[model samples]
Target: MPARYCQDSPDAIASCVLEDMVLLYHRPSGQTHMAIAPVPEILATLDDGAALTAGELLGQLAQLYDLGEPEEALPLVEAHLAELAALGLVRIA
Candidate 1:
């Protein structure tokens, strides 16, 4: 889904930081999720109200974080997106 524009699901998700992890509450689904590091980073990036593809997100992440190699980070970004999407915290456009 790298080429697809992805955005956070507004109104359905709420988040708070808990130590090293972020606790996400999906109001609509009544589900709670715990995320660390890149998960919270991805959410914060999308929280800007901008829709971006996985590659674009990876670029933003690279600027804000030291994710070793860009090539390796792509899959990691995709994985985070998948997890967020599954939890109703992100949507593809």
Candidate 2:
């Protein structure tokens, strides 16, 4: 299954950065979520207002960070996308 997602606005979610860790607050839900490293980067990529497929997201992320094999990272990326969706930070498109 290919997962795709996008963010409407930065204001919809508030984020704080502490070194590699990022704290994300979902304003509508009034819930706070924590992310680190590639997680934050992944959100930022989607926050650009473009719905991206999991493969596209992985390709973009690979450019920024060294991700081994796409086959190896696909499952991991999908898992992260699921976590992001669970947080209400992203949605399936």
Number of the top-ranking candidate, with TM-score as the measure: 2
What lDDT, from 0 to 1, does candidate 1 have? 0.80
Model 1 misplacement above 4 A: none
lDDT of 1 by residue, 1-93 (tens): 355545545566788988898898878788899888888788788887788888899898889789989889898888878877777788776
lDDT of each structure?
0.80, 0.86
Worst ten in a row by lDDT for model 2 = 1-10
lDDT at position 9, candidate 1: 52
Question: Which pairs, if any, clash in model 1?
Answer: none
Candidate 1, run of 10 with poorest lDDT = 1-10
> What clash pairs does model 2 have?
none
lDDT of 2 by residue, 1-93 (tens): 666787757688889998778999999889988888778888889988889988999999999889999999988988888888887888887
RMSD of 1: 1.8
